[model samples]
Target: MSLRDRVISTSVESSADPVELLSLKNPVHFLALGFGSGLAPKAPGTFGTLAALPLVWLLIQPGLWFYLCLTLIACLAGAWICGHAARDMGVHDHAAIVWDEVAGMLLTMFAVPLNWSTLLVGFVLFRLLDILKPWPISYLDKHVHGGVGIMADDILAGILACVGMHLLLEMGWLT
Candidate 1:
């Protein structure tokens, strides 16, 4: 269903806590919650980003085409996963729904050489951009709606981080 339809069709009381509604058994929720990493009581997004490390390691192994294709698939599919989970929880971009972070981290590390320093830099950069939400990123977060809305800001943050990583590489600041 469209985000507008879901919003109009459901009424979540302000007093009602939506976290209780999340069920990991539900595959949609499982993926949306970053394989349960998003369930962390504090900084779920951080934890969710951390959970992406293994994925980053794995994606970096194959050539760029494979990595890019898989990451693209995740980003596209994540939109549906996140939107469906939000609809189920009756919340918009709930903290527990962090598949966007997973996708963001994937994008952040794209094509960057796998190493401790690069990994750390990408992580910090993506997280900072995601949290600070500057300019166009902030604009997309506030203005966009539905699955696209939930994923747009993070995607941009990931792209920006990816660019930063490339810059660091080209500048010989990181190797």
Candidate 2:
């Protein structure tokens, strides 16, 4: 096979132990791996999102503009982070590269009231939207490629979750 073909087909061998990822020596891999939350044997996405919660709570305390600028930075930089990490792992969008979820959750909680109720509701909504991959989110997940592709679906899911969450609050449905 050609070098290009070989590179394109590169992916994590099934026999490799998932926990070995925790030994990643690279910084980008560490961040893209969601600080090891993606190392979880199951539901690593959920764990990655959960790991982002405390971070959001702390960061959002400053105000919306600060939170937004930071989230944008994270999202933009995360594309690179995830891309390099995936390449290192020899996989495309490995289950472990969940920094996308961090950016997604940040977007989901953006401008929303920082209360337990809103946080809980938004968390559920984000996970549901991400898992379900409704509409354009699903389209992006299927059609897009590379690190941008990995992050795009979660970003769309985050936008949807943000819209759903804000509606819930505005309508006084969840408070």
Candidate 3:
């Protein structure tokens, strides 16, 4: 089959098995929240971000540098993995591939304290920036393609979210 056909076929749903949904052996499966968020007919990205929260919370306590490093790794790896998966499935940046969200949230919380308010703000900001895709992010999203294209905009959004979160924290606005 052609590459595009493969991508489209990979995204097709036949069953609702949770195990099958979460399996990432195929890069696409690994990315689409194991297909969990992908299965959602509405707001899959939001669900994907929410699904990543627990992991992001756990990673945040290791220190800002560690989280930043992890986020970077995820972004880099996600580009490859998500891209491969998308190609395998005959698609581009599938909704089920939420590793981008995980990486983005990690970026958002990089320097922020681990608290509900901070987490909430980071979540809102990251999601808003990701969805809005402003400035360089929007530019990158339009101009870039492939694995880098899949992951670039979200990474930029994460950076923006991190900046916004830090500002809010510094100003004591979140407390």
Candidate 4:
């Protein structure tokens, strides 16, 4: 692996170890549960979002309102978890805390069809917008701090992803 990749991997691995991670209080543990997905050698954000898919799928089944509620809760909790974890690690937006991605992905899937094609498209679109940080997402990433810092950009990306997915659905392109 490349030097940068190796370093990020090491950081993520170290941070995600439950033994090491659980020693922390509330938010830290949640952040660690996201695993090292947030610290991928490349496309960490995309990896993080992908890592959340299984869990998101599980949570989304109840209904759109439930899913959206869960998304809001996750977003609020993610801020705490990410902030605490980042503080413990003595870093700003450490690569290991990916709960933000979890929340974002859930938001992206909100009100969208639960089919494989839609899920796949949502995942891809969310990751793209997240990585690109278009418009308000980019602005939020720069301007926000703490838990908001960790969660805001991804939330905005999720919104964009949702819009894209909705459009695709309307166009019958997701089938």
lDDT of each: 0.91, 0.84, 0.73, 0.75
In TM-score terms, candidate 3 sits at 0.81
- Residue 114 of model 4, lDDT score: 81
Q: Deviation in angstroms for 45 in model 4? A: 2.2
Give candidate 1 misplaced runs (Cα > 4 Å): 1-16
**Most TM-score-accurate candidate:** 1
User: Where is model 2 more than 4 Å wrong at Cα?
Assistant: 1-14, 18-25
In candidate 1, position 116 carries an lDDT of 91
In order, what is each prediction's RMSD in angstroms? 2.7, 3.1, 4.0, 7.0
Cα lDDT tens digits, model 3, 1-175, are 8755643554465433323323555545656453356556677778777776787877767777777777777888888776765566555676766667777887788767787887887889999999988899899889988878878888899889989887887888985
lDDT of 1 by residue, 1-175 (tens): 8654654444444545676667899899899999999999999999999999999998778788999999999999989999988887778999989999999999999989898998899999999999999989999999999988999999999999999999999999999
Cα lDDT tens digits for candidate 4, 1-175: 7543554466676765323433433546545447656656666667778888887788877877887787888888788887766655545776667778888888888888687888888888988888788888999999999878988998888888888888888898886
lDDT of candidate 1 at residue 82, scale 0 to 100: 93
Can you write out model 2's per-residue Cα lDDT over 28-59, one digit (the tens) per residue? Answer: 87889888788888999999999989989988
Q: Residue 37 CA error for candidate 3 (Å)?
A: 2.7
Ranking by TM-score: 1, 2, 3, 4
Error of 2 at 170 (Å): 0.8
Alpha-carbon error at 75 in model 2, in Å? 0.9
Best by lDDT: 1
TM, every model: 0.91, 0.88, 0.81, 0.79
